[model samples]
Target: MKKLIVICLFLAGWHSLLAGSPRNIMLILGSADPAVLQDRMDVALRLYTKQHFDKIIVSGGCAAHGSSICEASFMKEVLLKSGVSSSMIYKEENSKTTVQNYVFSRRLKEADGTLVMKPGDTVYVVSNHWHAISVAARLRKYDNLEAKFYIEGSIDPKPTDKLDYVSIFNGEPDNDKFVLKGTWLTPQAAWQEGDSTHYLTGSLVYVTDPQNMRFSVYERRKVFSGLEPYAAGRDLRFIDAGSSWYVWNGEKLLHVEKQERKVRSILSLTDLIPGLSPAWKYSLKAGAIYGDRLLLFSDSTLLVGKRKGKIFEIEQETAASAYFRNWPYSWGRGNVSAARIDPQTRKLYLYRNQECLELNAGLKSVQAPQSLRLKWIDKSK
Candidate 1:
C-alpha cells in the first residue's frame, strides 16, 4: 500500500507540471517589413485558432523609415484580413525593441481598456528564430510574467522566401528605409550640497549611468560655499587606460582607463561592480549583486564574495556554459557583458552577444526552444 501511494503521488506531480505550462502566448515582430509582419501574423493567427489560448497580443512601435505606422498596426490589419475576430486581438504600439514588445504587450488593456493579469501570469512569446532566446530573457525579468519562446524560421534563407518580405507594405521601398544605427550613450553626473552639521558639508555626489557604457562624477555646493577640490575616495577613482596608475581627480573624458596589469580583455572589465575599483585581484567578466554576496564570473569559473573581501570559488567547468546559456541574443557577437539573478527562482540569467539561453539548476543544462510551427493556411482567393 505504501509503494502504491508513492506512485500515485508521483503521477499527480507530473500531471501538474504539464497542466501548469503557459497557454497564453505573445508573438513579437522584429521588423515593420509588411511581408515579414504578414507572414509572422499568419503563423500566430493559425496557432491561436488551434490552441486553447484566450487572447493574442501583437507588439511593435514606430518604423525606422520615419513613418507613423507601427508593427502592431500592420499585424492587426493582416490578422483582421485573415478572418480572426477583431475582438480577440490586442495591440501594443509603443514598444520599439523586442524586450519592450513582450514587456509592454503582456500588460495590455482588455476590450474594456482595463489592465489584465495582476502578476504571476504564464505567457508564451513568439518571434524570429534568431531572436527567440533574448526575447525570453527580457520577458523573464518581469516578476509578474513567466515566459516561454518559439522561433519563426531558420537562419538560412530559402529561395521561396521573399527578399523584401519584411518591408513590403511600408510607405517607402526597403532601400529607402532608414536602418537603426547601433550606438552607445555616455553616463551623466549630478551633485547636491551637503549639510554642514552632518560632517559632509562639502557636497554630495551622484553618478548616473543608465546604459552602463560610461561613468562620471559631479560636485555641487551652496551658492555661498566655495568649490572644494574633489579628493581621491574609495567610492570614486579614475583608472588610466594608458597606464595602471589611478587618477586622484576625475578625468574630463569618459573613457575606460587603460590598466598596465595584464588582463584578459575589455569583456573582463564589465563585471566590475559599482563602488568596486577595476583593479581588483580577481577580474570579473560577468556578475550580479545578490544581498551581501556578489556573484562573479571570469573565464570559465564562478566566484561569490562580499565587497572588499576574498572571493569563494564555486563550480568552474560549468560556469562558461551556464553564463553563455543565459545571455540575451540582442547583445550581438563578441562576449556577454550583462547578467541577472532571479531571486524567486534562484536562477541566473546571462546575455551574451545576441543569444539568450537559460541554465536549469536541477538538470544543469541549457535549452533554447524555437517558435512553434504554425499550420500554414492558404488564404489566396
Candidate 2:
C-alpha cells in the first residue's frame, strides 16, 4: 500500500505539468518582400480561425519602400477585412528589427499597449519555420527551460528534416545535455547607478549590499524586507547600457518613479514630458533622455524636445540615421545584449563578452576594446 501511494503521488505531479494551455500565445509575423506579405498573412489568418487565444499581437515595422503603413498596421487591416473584429487584434508598430518584434511583444504593460506579460506568465511563441530559432532564443535572458515554443506553417516539422533554423530552434544537445546560449551568457540586461549596480539574471536578483561593498546575489530570499517592488524594465533609467538600480517587491516587476526624496508610480507620460499634448501619441522609433531635453530618432532626424506643459514637444535638430544604422555593428551582429553608463564618468559601457568597450556620451568609442573574464551561471530556476 505504501509503494502504491508513492506511485500515485508521482503520477499526479506529472499530470499537472502536462495540463493547462499557456495563458498567452502570439503569432509573430515575418517580414519579407511585399510580394510575399499576402502568403504569410494567409497562414496567420488560418491559424486565427482555428485556435482560441487570449490576445493576438502583430509585430512589424515599415513595409519596404519607406511607407508610413507599418507591417503591424497592414496585418491589422487584413484581419479586419476578413471579418475579424478590430477589438481582437493588437498592433505593435514600434519594431524596426526582428529582435525588437519578439522582445517588445512579450513585455508586460498597464494600458494602451499590446499586452502586459508578468513574470510568471508563460508565453508560447509562434513563428514561421525559418525564423523560429532566432525568435525563440532572444525572447528571454536565461536558458528558457520554462517556456514552450512552436513553429507555424502549412505543414508540421519532421524530426529528420535538415533545416538550420529548425535544428537550432529544437535545441542542440552536447553528449546528454542541451547547450543554450543567450543574454545570460553575457551581462546584458541590467542597470548601474553610483557605487552599486543592480542586475536581474533569470529570476534571481543581484546587487551591492552597500553595507559591504561586495556584491550579493538574492536567491529566492526577500531582497528588500519591506520595501515595495518597482517595475523592472518599464520604470527604468539607464545609468549605462547594462546596469541600473530597480525597486523590487519580492515577486513581480514593480513600476515606480523617483525624484529627489519622493518616489511615485508613473501615472502618465506627462509626469516626465510635461509639455506633451494629451491627444498626441507618437510611435517612439528610437530615443534617449539628455538633460531637460529628449533626443528622439525618427524620419532620419534627431529631434530635441522638452517638457513644457500638458505634453512634451520635439523639433528636428539633425540627421538621426547614423545611430540606428550603426547599432548592429557597434553592439554585435545579434541583439543588443548588455550596455551600461557611468553617471559620474559620463561614459557608456557595452558588454560583448569577446571584448567589452567603453564609449563616450556621444556614442563614440573612447578607447580600444578590453577583454574581461566572464562567468556563466546555472539556469535551472
Candidate 3:
C-alpha cells in the first residue's frame, strides 16, 4: 500500500510541474501619457492578482516625444507602484513597434538555453483595444504560442489610429477603399499563392486561374504581396477568421490575408522582425517566404522567423555581393533582391539584376549565378 501511494503522489507532482513549467505574461506598451500608462498597468495588476505569472514581460522602446524614456521603463514604474515583485517582471526595453515587442521578448531565454516562454506556456498580452487587434494578429502568427489576450481602453481615446487598424482588418491597405485600375505588369509584389498566381500590378491586385491563365477576380488593394512571403501549407488558424491574405499597400498596412487557396507552408515577414519597414516608401531590400520562415536579406544580415516561437538568425557573406562585378554600374542592379524555393526541396534560387543563382537548401553556399532566361516574358511589351 505504501508503494502504490508513493507512485500516485509522484504522478500528481509531475502533472503539477508540467502545468507551471512555462509561465509568461507579456504586456504591449501604450502611449507614454501618464493616465494611459496607468490604465494599462491597472489591467495588468488585475490579471496578476488572479495568477501571478513567472515573468511579466513588458515591451516597447520609447514613450514618444523623443524623450530618453522608454515605454518598457515607464511600464516598469507602474508595475513597481502596483506592488508587482521586481524579481517577477522582465522588461524588453528596446522595442519601439508591436513586432519588436514580440521578437525581442521571445529572444529572452533561461541560462540553459530554453526559451522563457516555451511552446505550451500561456502568454497574456495587454494592450489598448485597437492596438490589441494588431497585437493578437501578430501574436497568433506563432503556431506554438498558447496566448490569452486582453485589451484596455485609453482614458482619452484616439479614433484615428483605431480606425486605421479597422481598415487593415477589412483588407484595405493604406486605410483607403479599394480602387479599380488597368492591367499592367510593373508589379509591386508577385506571389504564387496555392495554385493561383497573384500580382499587385500598379494600383490593382489580380489573381489568375491555375489551370488556364484567366482572370478569377480582382483582389483590389491586395498588391502588397510582401506580407505573407511564405505560404507553404493549408494552415488556417489566423486570429481573424475572415482573413484571406496579409499585405502592405504603401503607407496603408493591412494585416489581411488572402485565402484564395491552400498549401503546406505559409510565411509572413510583417510583424516578425524587430524593426521592419513594410511601407511601400521603403520596400524590403530582399525577402522570401520559404518553408516555415520568412527569409529577409538586408545588406549581409539574414533574419529567419520560426513559427514555433523562436527566431534563428544566419549571417553569411552573400554570394551575390560579387555577382555582376564585370558589369558597369553594378551597384544599381547587382544586389540580390529576392529568393524562392524549388518545389523539389533540393535547392533555393535567388534573383539579382539579370542573374539567378542557385544555392543549397541550407543557404550556406551557392553556385555561380547565370543570366536569367526569360523565355515567356515579352520584352517587346
lDDT of 2 by residue, 1-381 (tens): 999999999999888865433445555554644534566677677766776655566766553234435577677788779987766666665454454455446542334332344444455455555565555554443334234456555645478665545344345343112221322233423445456655544345556544534656664224322222343333222212112122322222223232221233334444444554432223222333444445543222355566455344665355433442343232322222244546567665555433456667666766655544334444322
Could you give candidate 1's per-residue lDDT for residues 178-247 as a string of tens digits? 1111001100111112211100111332233433243332333322122122333311222222222121
lDDT of 3 by residue, 298-345 (tens): 322344444444443333223233332332222222223445554555
lDDT of each: 0.42, 0.46, 0.49
The alpha-carbon RMSD values of the candidates against the true structure, listed in the order shown, are 22.0, 13.0, 15.9
Candidate 1 lDDT: 0.42
Ordered by lDDT, highest first, the candidates read 3, 2, 1
For model 3, the local distance difference test gives 0.49
Each candidate structure's TM-score, on Cα atoms with residue i matched to residue i, is: 0.35, 0.42, 0.39
Worst 10 residues of 2 by lDDT: 237-246
Which one is best on TM-score?
A: 2
RMSD of 2: 13.0
lDDT of 3 at 280: 15
Q: Order of all candidates by TM-score, from best down to worst?
A: 2, 3, 1
